[model samples]
Structures are given as structure tokens and as C-alpha cells.
Target chain A: MNTIRLAVDGVNKIYAGQATRVVAVEDASAAFAEGSVTAIMGPSGSGKTTLLSILGLILKPSNGRVTLMGRDVTDLDEARLPELRRQHIGFIFQSFNLFSALSALENVLVALQLKKVARPEAEAAARSALSRVGLEQRMRFYPRDLSGGEKQRVSIARALATNAPIILADEPTANLDSHTGLAIIDLLAELAREQGRTVVVVTHDTRMQEHVDHTLRMEDGRVYEN
Target chain B: MTYPVPMARRNLFHERVRLAITLVGIAFSVVLILVQMGVYLGMMNNTSSIIDHTEADLWVTARNNSNFDFSLPFPEHRENTAKGVEDVLWVKKFILVWSLMKLDGGGSENVEIVGFDPETGIGGPWEMVAGDPRDVKYPKGVIVDESSFAKLGVAKVGDDREIYGSRVRVVGICRGAKRITTAPILFTSYKTAQELNPWMAGKTVFLLVKTAPGADVAEVQQRLRAVMNLEDVYTQADFAWATKKYWTLSTGIGLGFGFTILMAIFVGAVIVSQTIYSATIEHLREFGTLKALGAENRTVYGIILQQALLSGLMGYAIGLAINLVISDLYRRTGQLVVQPWQLFAADLVVTLATCVAASLISVRRAMQVDPMEVFRA
Candidate 1:
């Protein structure tokens, strides 16, 4: 029997600007199990990214309880949230948020180092992660020197090096061509099936649905199974 | 071993031209302050060179005399009075006068004429490069410092020169007897110096007194003051300090250099702070990402501070190298480079202060960056 790695019950997110207030996520409930790849699909401004941000602990829901691996993290102290994210949740942004000055290997090493991994183990793990992403030869290249697909792959390696049980990717292939995007989706699916990791991907692209176990279609601020 | 250090170094060295310009600006400021400070220290050292080189327990000058160069003549019998003081080992009469030296081509140069009892070697020129101290015992014999050889237009020993219309022959060339006020020192016997200046014929300008070994110099100074009755008495060190104070505080040299150094510090700090701040701004996204990746605020601050310290160390080394070359080129002035250890120690303290102060704004900016911004497109 599979285990539930992350669950959000009656989650809501409201973004209040100086002149307006808009609800980004509303009463959304979802559960991601170990060894499953789930995609939250929606159009622009459909609150898909907000829901994923909540799941990654980047944003706290206005009214919700979030549990990760049997621990309730929704009410966790803000100071301790980063530690939780570092130990349990790995994040991949759409822009591939890689440090421009660091090489691909160093980029992956940063995540492991943040988890307080020893230097020797971190280096070996970084090399292995880059190699797993088919980027062993390009590990010394900086982000600026990388192509769109290679940069995204390096970001994937960085997230993977954290050894986090849950991986939250926000539109991981939005900037790539269809072929590259498909390859990235396949890579995420491989992590779920082969490594037994829980993967939740937020994107507007429906092509991502083909590789995941299921899709949750979000419209406005409400989420429903598709 | 820390992540911030390598990240900071890579960011600073990423653009070679920018890094070079930044280092040059910092080094230029460091040299500016050092040279200004060096000139001030050189002047202070020069004012005290005479007292420092001479060995004496007490100096008796005409009342109210502020420096040795400006001393006026008092009764010659005061030297005998100092000799009678308790613990006084011996006393010798000395004279100093500004004499006009007649050049071969009819050009005249003003030189400081110092006269001493050559037999006792009291108040005599120290560090002779050629000729003997006893050579000044000969009639019409004098000593000229090598530093003033070119200025006085004279060759080595045996060259005849006229001062105050009285003929004199150079018997020795000395080193390390450099004088401030741009006056070359000419050492001679007390009788010849008196013959050269008629107004000082029956008087002595200074009385050099030495106390017995194991004697307290301060007590001897007091005894000489009481015995002389109408002359100011000072130990050698005290007299040198008074001379230095006159030049440094009363002559406006100290204030002038102080202002320049202050301006250099401000200019150096401003340039470093702005450069580091802009560099941090350029890497704000990276900092935000690091924060989002669970790096603490201290870690981000470490990167800015590391960059500043590295810049300061490099700039200090470059500045000192360039200063040494400049000092060597102008060493003939004898007042350009004085104290090496003091200047280097002061440079280190100022450089660290400047660079550390410079990084504060950058560190603050880095900490203010929100990790959540990394999610923004």
C-alpha cells in the first residue's frame, strides 16, 4: 500500500494588494501519494501556481492544514519553515532560477550543502545527480552558457540533490520546445515510478497530463478532478 | 569551505574589467592617504633629528627660545655656571647662526652654521662619511653634509668656501645630518663660527651639559635651570619634542595633512561602498534564490563581507607597492619617506575599516531580498 506524503485540506489563499483583494486558492483539497506524479492544470491566473506555492511552503494558505509525511506543517513557525522545505520539499521554478555565476555542478551542490551534507558526500552526490540528468559533461558550464533544456535539467538536478521526499515543480517546461518539455515530463514521471517520490507539477500545458498518474483541473480559484 | 565565500569570489571576478577598476580606485585612495601621512611624519622626524643624534643631559638656550634654530645668544659665562651644577659631568658652549655662503658664480645660499667644542665632540655632526671629527680642530675647518653637496656646489673635503665673508675649508662630509627649513648644515669650531658672526662674538647661543652616569636627567635639567638663572634648560628629548610641537601644531603642517587624510578616507569609503552596493544589487536574484534554498541571512551577508575584505587586501598590497616606488624616486628630498612600520600599520587599520564600512549597505540590501521573489517571473 502506498503512503500519502502530502495533503492539503480546505486550503485557501488570498492576495491583498493596496487597492484590491483577490482569492488565489479557494477551499482546495488534494492528496499526493508516494510513487505518484500529479499535475495541477489550469490557464493563466487560474491559481494553479498559488496552490503549488502553498504545497511547497513558499506561501501559507489563509485557512488550511497542510500535512507532510504525517506531520502537520500548516501551523509550523515561519522560522522553521525553511528547514522543513530543505529537508522534505524540493522546488523547481519555471525560470530555472539558477545562480548565473555557478556551474551546473556547483548549482546542484548548493542544495546538498544547504541540507548540511558533508562536502565530500555533497560533491559525489552532485556529480551523480548531474550524471543522472545526462549532464555530466556539461557540469562545469554556467547557467548563462546553457541552453533552455540544459538549464532546466540543471535545476532538476539541484532539486533532486536535496533528497526531499516531495518535489513541487512550477511550470518546469514553460520555456522549452514541445520535445524538450515532453522529455522533462518523462523525467519527472521516472522519479515518481522508479524512486517512489511524490511529484506535483503545476502547469497550463495539457501535454504534461499524459505522463502523470492524474490531473487536477483548476478554474478561477477552485480545483476539481479531471 | 562555506558556500558564500566561493560564491562571493566568483561574482567579484566574473567581470575582469570591473574588478580591475574597483581595485585601482581603492589602491589610489590608499596611496593618497599614505603619501600625505608620510610627508607629515617626515617633517616631524626632521625637526627632531639634531636632538636625536646628539647626546646630552641638558640644553641651555636663551630665555623664551622655542627651537634650537631660533636660539639667541646669551652670556658665554652661563656655560661655566651649568658646569658648577650638582651632578653636572661637564658643559660645553655651542653656537648656531644663519650664514650666507658665497658660491663660485656669485650666487649665495643660506646655510645653518653649527659650532661646537671639537675637542670634546660636543654638539658635533654625527655619522661622518669622510674625514675625521678631529679634522674640525684645524683652523678654518668645517664639515658639510653629503646631502647638501650638490646644493652647496662644493666637492669633497678640502674644498674652500666663504661664509659671512670669512674663508673656511671643508674637512669632512657627513651622512644623516639632514636639516628641515631647506638649510644645509655647516659644522665648524666655536672660535671660527664666532669670527664669522661679529654680533655673537662675546656670547654663546646654547650650553650643552652632560650629567654623571646614573644621574637623573630631569633633576640635572632642574639644577641647570636654577644655576643659569636667565636661560631655559631642557633635556634633549624634551627639547626635541618642543621643536616637533612647534612645527607640527604651530606651523599648520599637521592640520594640512590631517585634512587631506580625512578626505582620502571619505573618498575611499564612498567609492568602495557604492561599488560593492551595486555589485550586490546585480546579484540580488541570486541572493534571493539562495535564501529560498534555505540559506540563512548570515550566509548572504557573508558573501558581501567576503568580497569587501578581498578587495581591501588586494588594494592595500597594490597601494604599498606603488608607494615604495614613489618614495625611492624622491628619496633625495630627505623628507618624503620617514617611518615604514608606522605607515604600514596605519594603512592596514584604515583599509580594513574602509572596506568593512563599505560592505554594510550591500549586506543590508542582500538581507532585504525576499526569498519568495524567486518564484516571480
Candidate 2:
């Protein structure tokens, strides 16, 4: 059996307002194994993104415990949580989220620099990461100069450059055409399987299930595995 | 890990038009504050230059003398009394009178008539740009400052001008004898000044006393005060301070300059804060992305602070370069000017502080950026 790189037990997330309380995730529990690709699939408002956010440590559960590499982080202080996130988690956003001011190589290098990698090594690592995504030729282009697939590839390179064991991608293919989206998913799955890192992708695209080791369907804030 | 410098430079330079406008605003504020301060300093220097440049160790004036502008005169015998004081190597009778000058053309100009004893040449124009100081001893002789040559309608030595209807020849021309009262000054012998202003015939407005080397100035002042019995005894520095204090605090010029300075500061802070705040808002999503990438609040603050300081530094350099040109223009106007290094250093600190203060609003907004927006968007 593969080692479980991350797990969340009985996690719940709710947004409280003066007049109402909205529950984003309810009793969502799942274990993502190392060296495998997992897809959390659900329709809109089904809490798939919320579960991904919680797993990425961007949002804290209203009630639950989170385990990362065998350590519980449910009670981690907010001040120290970012440091922990930088050291362990890498994220690929739906909008690509590349810094428009930076070139593709700098976008990746900035992420590595934030991860506390030295400049010289960060440059080498950024180049290698961009090459891994077949974007070496486009590494010097700004996000505005690049196409949709190129931008997505730059973000993937940014996430990969961090060398974190857990990569969380939210609706990674939502803005891409099917062919480009499939190509990205295939690259991600191969990188995860070959590099022994866990990749959890949140999506409603049923085609994503074909390339992942397992699919966990989310509905109304609840999770069920297939 | 530490891309604050590059990040700030890129962010500020991204929009060239906005960047130029922001820099211009900052530079204008700096220049306004600096020029206002320079003018005030120039005014102070003009007010005290007569005393500062003179070679007198002790000055004796009327007991309630407010300033050189409206000086009160005492009996000429006070000079003899001061001369008797121990350590008083020499004493010269000094006179000052405000009189109308009969210009060569139709109109008349206001003139400050300053008279010093020709024997000692004390309290006389020190910077002789042309001609000899001794020539003022000639009949109805006078010396005009080079800076006031154009205003006095005289070109060179041997040029003639009339003061209080007396045709006085400009025996010499000197520089840096600046006027604070907006009137050009004409230097003459005590006898000629006394003859011109009959009211000053038997009186002297001031006694310029020189002390021997190693003589205690305070002791000489004490002895002169006791000997004269009715005049105020002042060291050179005390009289200069008194003159400066009267012009700066007694008059409203200081308040006017001070108010303008505060306004400049307000305008600068507003412009800088608005520019930086607007830029931050424009890049709100970028900062959100940084937070999502696990950057701490301190990191965001660092970035904003770096941006502000960068603008301040560049703006300050540009402002100073412009000030150099402005100072030259001011110098041509014949105003007393001094820009010590300390002023530049202090202004630099103030400029940086202004920029830092202006960045607080932006930094607060930047720190509150929600990393979740990167995903939600």
C-alpha cells in the first residue's frame, strides 16, 4: 500500500453572516496517497472547491483535524500556517494566477524564491521546471503575451518548481479547450506518478476521471469515493 | 524570496504615465518645501548678514532697539565712554538712516544710509568688488554694493548718486551687503551721514567696538554697559540672534512661510498616498496571488514600503537637481543664500518619512488581501 501523504477527518467549513450561516463543506473526509493522482469531482456548489481549499490550507475547517505527512495541523497558528504552506503545499489556480508583471521564467523563479531557494539554484530549478512542462521556449514571455494553454503551463511550472510533495489544482482545466485540458491533465498525472508526489485536482469534468488513480465524488458538501 | 526591490520597481514602472505623474507630484512637493525653507533661510541670513560679516567684538545700541530697521540713536559721547572700557582696542561711531535717493532719471528710490568712521574703517563694507574702502573718506563719498548696482542705477566706481538730495559719488562697489528691508544700501563716512541727516548730527545709532586679542568679550561688554550706562551691550552673536528673532517671530513673514511649508507637506502626502493607494488597488489581485503563494503580511508590507521609498528617493534626486537651478536664479536676485549640507540631509529624512507615511494606507490594504481570491477568481 502507498503511504498517505495528506488526510482530513470529519472536516466542516461554514461562512457565518449576521442573518445566515452557509455551510461550504460538511463531514468531508478523505485520504490522498503519495505518488498518485486523485480527482475530487462534483457539480457546482457541491463543495469540491471548498474541500480543495481546506486541503490546501487556504481555509480552516470549522471543526476537524488535518493531517499532513503524519502530523496534525488543525490547531496550527495562523501566523505560522503560511510558512508551513510554503514548505509543503503548491497550488495551481483556475485562472492561472500568474503575475502579469513577470515573465514565465520569473513567475516560476519567484515561487521557488518564496520557497527559500537560493537565486542561482532557483533559476536553474525554474528553467528545469518550465522545460518539464515543454515551455522552455516560452519561458521569457509575459502572461499577457502568452496564450491560455501557455499561461496554464507557466502556472504548472510555478507549482512544480516549489518541489512540494502535495500539489493542489483547482479547476485546472476549466478555462482550456478539451484537447489542451487533456494534455495538461496528462502532464500532471505523469509528473505525479513519476516524481512520487500526490496531485489532488478539483474538477467537475468527468473526463478527468479517466487519467486519475481514484475519483471522489462530492455532493452537497459530502464526499464519497469510487 | 526577497523580490521586494524588483517587484516594487516593476509595479511602479508598469504604467509609464501614472509613474511619471506620481514622480512629478512627489518631486513638486519636495521642491516646494525645499524652496520655501531656502527662502526663509535666505531671509534670516539677510537680516543678520550685517552683524555676521562685521569685525566687531562688541556692539552698543539703544536700550530698546528692536532691529536695524528702526534703530534708535544715542549721544555720540557714548562712543568715548565705550572707548574707555578695558580691552576696548578701538570704537567707531555707526549711523543708519532711511532716506530717499534722487535717481538720475525722474523717479526716486528708497535707500538705507549706513555711516561708519573713516579712520578705523570699522563696520564698513567688507567685500569690495571694485574700488578702495579708503575712497569713502573723500568729500561726499559713498560705496554701493555690487548686487545693488543695477537697482541703484550706478555702474562702477566714480558713478554719482544722490541720497536725501546729497550728490554722493560711489567711491567703491562691494558684494554681499544684502538688504533685508527691500531697500538698497549706500555706505558713507560718519561725517557725511551726519551732515545729510541733521537729526543724527549729535548722535550715533550704534558703537562698533573691537577688542584686543585674548580679551574676554563678556568682560568688555560688562564694562562698556557700565560705562555707557544707558545703552544695550551685545556681542556680535547676541545682536545677530536678536535681529533674526525679531524678523522671524515678531514679524509675520515666518508664519507665512511656515503655513506654506505645511501646505506643501499636506499636498505631497495626499498625492503620494493617493498614487500608492491607487496602485495597490490596481494590483490587488497580484498581491492576492502573493498571499496565496504563502507570502506573509510582513512580506507584503515590505513590498509596499519598498515601493514608497523608491519613489521618494528618485523624486528627491530629481527635486534637488531642480533646486540647484532654482538656487542659481535666486542668487541672481541678490538675496542672502546658504544651503548647508545639514539641510539636504534633514530634507532627505523628511522626504523618506513622508513617503513612508503615505504608504501606510496601501500597506494595510495589501495585507488584507485574501489569498482565496486567487482561486475564487
Candidate 3:
């Protein structure tokens, strides 16, 4: 009976182009609960990433309401969305998206600093987050110098450093080896069960189902519970 | 946080070669602008050097006198007319003409002949390196600047040359007596000048007037104008500025130099814009990630603007350092290249402004990046 941390009610996303119209997500409805890991499994071009983008507040849905912690936020101003995302949502990208110029420690520090955390405290928090991801020894290594698994660990540390309530990961293990991918999935499950943070992952790998608490399937821009 | 990560600095420094090339481009533009502006100012200063260094309170010349180098002769009696004015302590006749000097080797070089009374030392050479200003009183004696030795084909004091086909001995050597036209300057007595150029006899080009102590120079100029109704009257400062204006505006030098400065700015702006834009394009995915991570537009703008400012500051520093070295070298070679503090300040402002303006293009591109792009594999 956990509270619904994030939910989208009949949300629709349409990308209108000069030559054609794309219904990226059509009448999508789903609820993600706190203290649980949910995986949205879908094929290519199935609008899973689009739905995740809407949930992360990175994209605006054309119609329908979005609820976060029981408050409807669908009609919020665009200007207010960034602050809201910064305060509540943490994003993990498929490519790890680490600033190549910064070291792993600095990558985590940037996330905390963006939330206006004090520098002294932000540094400690970044170090602690990196340690939590078991990357304490590789904190000073840049993205170009690290392996794929280490880069993904640094990305997870950056997301964890923000301490956001909801974590939205788009293909978090898409670029990692099978063993490393399972380890990352296990880490996300540990973050949900142990830390009580609602974690939603959009992935095409069926192997993630064994590690997640709930699973949903997406195809042709529609979502179905499994 | 008040101080975010040094992302801008790190980003610029990431590609060492590109950064070096960018800085070189910016520094080159800065140096070009500074040198051109310095040369223009130096030439303008030279145009008015004679009027600026003289001790005369007022200058009376023929009506509609264009500049110090070019003037019509008035009757020598105007000196007496100027002397009669109230508050006028004394007045001396000044002669200035252009003639060819017969070089000792074979060819002739253009020379500006300046004649003033040696007794009063009015309108005479102010900085004498060798011999004396009064030495010009000797018959056919002339004072030449050491800087003009190569052009005039004379080595030192006592060297002989011919002015207007008349033999003249260099009795003195002066320093820093340059003209805007780059012609060698020769100073002589009124008698010797008239002896060499018979056309200037009984006619003077200017009258240098000294006023009594504590007298209003402007009032004295007005009185002299009333007494010599047809001649132009100017205070020393006014005359200097008029000479500068005539050379700067009446001639096309100002327009040419202005065009050069503008072109330098244009080239600098383009270089800066391209560097920043390319850097932005290279890190487009990182910027998209920042946006997806909830960075505001202002933060992105701040980072890019910081990079531009850092580039500007470093480039300007290097350029100024090089300019100072070059200015010193030019000074040693007896070429005046004036770089005042005001010029440095203005150049810095222009550099920063160009850098900031250049960053707008990058900022616009960064703003258009969709945050969702980071999610695509």
C-alpha cells in the first residue's frame, strides 16, 4: 500500500512536424509506487523513452495530467518545470552523458551544485555518493579514461547525489556488458528497496524483469501492465 | 552553488591545440588594432608637435590657415601690429617652408625648413641633443634632428648640406622633432631662411606672440585679431588642436585607419564566434544532458559567457604585453608610437565587448537544444 510517487493519467505526446505528425505516446496511463523498481519494456520506437521524458519533466505532454506525490503538475509553467525537476527528479541517460572535461567526482558535484547545495557540503555528498556506487578508487578518473561499467557507476553516483525522490533512467544498462548490466540493475533495485526512492527504468532487455518489482509493456504508443 | 564547477575553463582547455589557435587569433586581432591606433595617435601628435612645444601665447597667421605645415605668408609688419596690442609682452616672426635638400650622395630629399629668431628662442627646437638652439644664429647654420640623419644623408653636427641650392652647415642636432609627413625637419634663423629662399623675403608665415604674466590669453588673442583684422588668431592649445584636426579630418588618413580598426574588430569577432560555436557543437550532448539534469537556461548561458570572457581576458593580456614590447622597440628606433593608458582601457573594453557579442551565437544554439535529445541512444 505504498504511496504513488509518480503517475501519468491518459497522457498523450504529439510531435507535430511541417511534413508529418508523430503520436509519440497515445493515452498512456501508469503509476509508479515508492520503495519499488518498475521497468517499462518496449520495442524500438515504442514511445517508452518519450513516456520516461514526460515523467522526468524533460518534455511536456500534449494532453492529460501528470501527478507527482499526489499533486497534479500537468499545467505548471515551463519556467517552473526546471526547478521542479531539479528538486524532485533525477535522470540517468543511456550514454552516461558525463561531461568529458570533468572527472567522476566533479560529475557528481555538478548535480549537487545545480540544486544550490553549499560547496563544502556538496563535495562531501558527492564523495559519499561515489563511494556508495563503489567507485571511490576511480573518483578522479575522467570519462575517457574509465571503462563502460565505471562510467555507468559514475552516472549513477551523479543521480544519487541529488537525493531526488524519483529516479528516471532511460536504458541505463544499454551500453554495458551482460554481467555489468545485471549489476547496474541490481543497484537500481537496491536503491529502491533500501532507500525508498521510486525508480522507473525504460529498457528493451527482458532480463531486467527478474530484478524489478513491477513490469509494464509498451508497443504502438500504448502501455499495458504485465 | 555560488561558484559552480569550472566547466567553462575546463571545456576551453580540453582541446589544447584548438585553444591555442583561438587565443592566437584573438591576440593577433588585438595587436593589429592596438598598433594601428597607436600609430595614428603618434602621427597626430607629431602633426601638432611644433605648436604644442612652443612657448607662444598666441599665433597670428594668414586668414584661413589650414594647418601648421601649409600656410600662406603675411606681411612681416604683422609682428609689429601684434606687438602693439595690450598685454602683448613681445612678438617674433616665424617662417616655415618646404624645400628639397641636396643629399651628399646623389638624390634630393624633401625637407621642412623652420625659421625663428634665435634671440627670443620662440618657435625653436625644444630638445637639443648636441650643440645648442642658439647655434642656428651663425650664418647659414641649421639644426637637424638626429632621427632625420639617414633621410637627410647627414651623419652628425657640422655636416654640410644644401637647402634650395644654398650650402648650409648643421650646427646642432635635436631629438623628437618629427613631422606628420615624414619629411626631415631643419631649423634655421630668419635671416638664413630668407637668404636661402628669396621668395620668403619680407614675408612671414606666422607671428608668435607672448602675453604679459597673468593675462587672459583668449582676450589677448581677440585684441590681436582686432589689430590685425585679416590674419587668423589662435591660442596655443587651439592651434595645436586645429593642426591635429586638419591632419585627421581634412585628410583621408583618419578614414583609412578607422577602416583598418573596424576590420580588425570584425575579424576578431568572427574568430571568437567560430571557436565558441564549434566548442558548443562538439559538446552538444553534454549540454543536452545538463538541460535534462534540470539546468536552467541562465546557467548554460553563464557557462558559455564565462568561456568567452576568459578567452578575451587572456588574449587581451597577451596582446597588450606584445604591444608594449613593440612600442618600446619603435621608440628606440626613433619612431613615435604613443600608447596612452586611455587607449589600453578602451582596447580592453572593445575586446571584452567583442567576446561577449560573439558568445551570443553559441548561447542561441545551446538554448535551442532539446533536453530530450540526451535520451536517444
Best by lDDT: 3
Q: Give the TM-score of candidate 3.
A: 0.95
Worst 10 residues of 3 chain A by lDDT: A78-87
Interface RMSD of each: 2.2, 2.0, 1.2
* TM-scores of the candidates in the order shown: 0.90, 0.94, 0.95
Candidate 1 lDDT tens digits, B263-355: 888888888898888888988988877777777778788888988998888888998888887777658555546757978898888887899
Residues B192-234 of candidate 2: C-alpha lDDT, one tens digit per residue: 8898888887999998999989999998888888877788989
Clashing pairs in 3: none
* Residue A155 C-alpha lDDT in model 1: 91
lDDT of every predicted structure (CA atoms): 0.84, 0.85, 0.89
Off by over 4 Å in 3: B1-3, B86-89, B211-214
Q: What are the chain A TM-scores of the candidates, in order?
A: 0.97, 0.98, 0.98
Tens digits of per-residue lDDT for model 3 on B1-377? Answer: 22468899989988887778778878888898899999999998899888888889888889999689998898998787788899999888899988889887889999889998999778889999899889999889999977687797655787888877788998999877899888999899988887888989899999998999999988998888888998999998888889888998999998999999999889989999999999998888888888777888898899999999999999999988888888788778777898788998999999999999999999999989877779877
Worst 10 residues of 1 chain A by lDDT: A49-58
- Alpha-carbon shift of residue A185 in model 3 (angstroms): 0.2
- Clash count, one per candidate: 0, 1, 0
Say which prediction, candidate 1 or candidate 3, comes out ahead on lDDT. 3
Q: How does residue B216 of candidate 2 score in lDDT?
A: 92
